[model samples]
Target: MTDVTLMDFHADWCGPCKTQDPIIEEIEEDYDEVTFEYVDVDEEPDIANEYQVRSIPTIIVKNEEGVVERFVGVTQRDTIEDALSQAGN
Candidate 1:
């Protein structure tokens, strides 16, 4: 079971991912129940392959049973909140 997992695929050289870090950190702060995992594409190639990540700053929100619901680029606070809220329900 997933039990609310948010995986962020990123790279150290990615400017967009750096720009999006604060927003994600804020989301992590807001959603205490949600578990966040950060995978560096450069270091964790296996994970990137498992997730089929093609770009940096990819956010994958998975529910229980490891089913992915949201898979996209950098996400905003409201968007993440809404997604989490829906996942909770």
Candidate 2:
């Protein structure tokens, strides 16, 4: 299994999520060491509920040890990279 995983929770109809998707995709392309995954809230409500996601564009970064960081809404690239660095990605 990958050491670090970035979970992006979003829905197709969400405007903010649409904006966030490309940013996440860009991060995925830039970070080969970090695993990136997308969860469509509309299709996977269970996963959203498990993560306690109350809004769209929720991002969860975790490693094998456990969760490193989590944020909601639009996030800065440097901030995400910092979390990945801390998580040993």
Please write out the lDDT profile of model 2 over residues 1-89, one tens digit for every residue. 34899999998889998888878888999989888888998999999999899898999999988888999999888888888888884
Worst window of 10 by summed lDDT in candidate 1: 65-74
Instruction: Give the Cα-based TM-score of candidate 2 against the true structure.
Output: 0.92
The predictions' CA RMSDs to the true structure, in order, are 2.1, 1.8
Deviation in angstroms for 54 in model 1?
A: 0.4
lDDT, candidate 1, 2-69, per-residue tens: 26877888899998898778989999987888899999999999998888889878888878756455
Task: Kindly report which residue pairs in candidate 2 clash with one another.
Answer: none
Off by over 4 Å in 1: none
Give the whole-model CA lDDT for all candidates, comma-separated.
0.80, 0.88
Candidate 1 lDDT score relative to the true structure: 0.80
Q: After superposing candidate 2 on the true structure, give the runs of residues whose Cα lies further than 4 Å from its correct spot.
A: none
Error of 1 at 6 (Å): 0.8
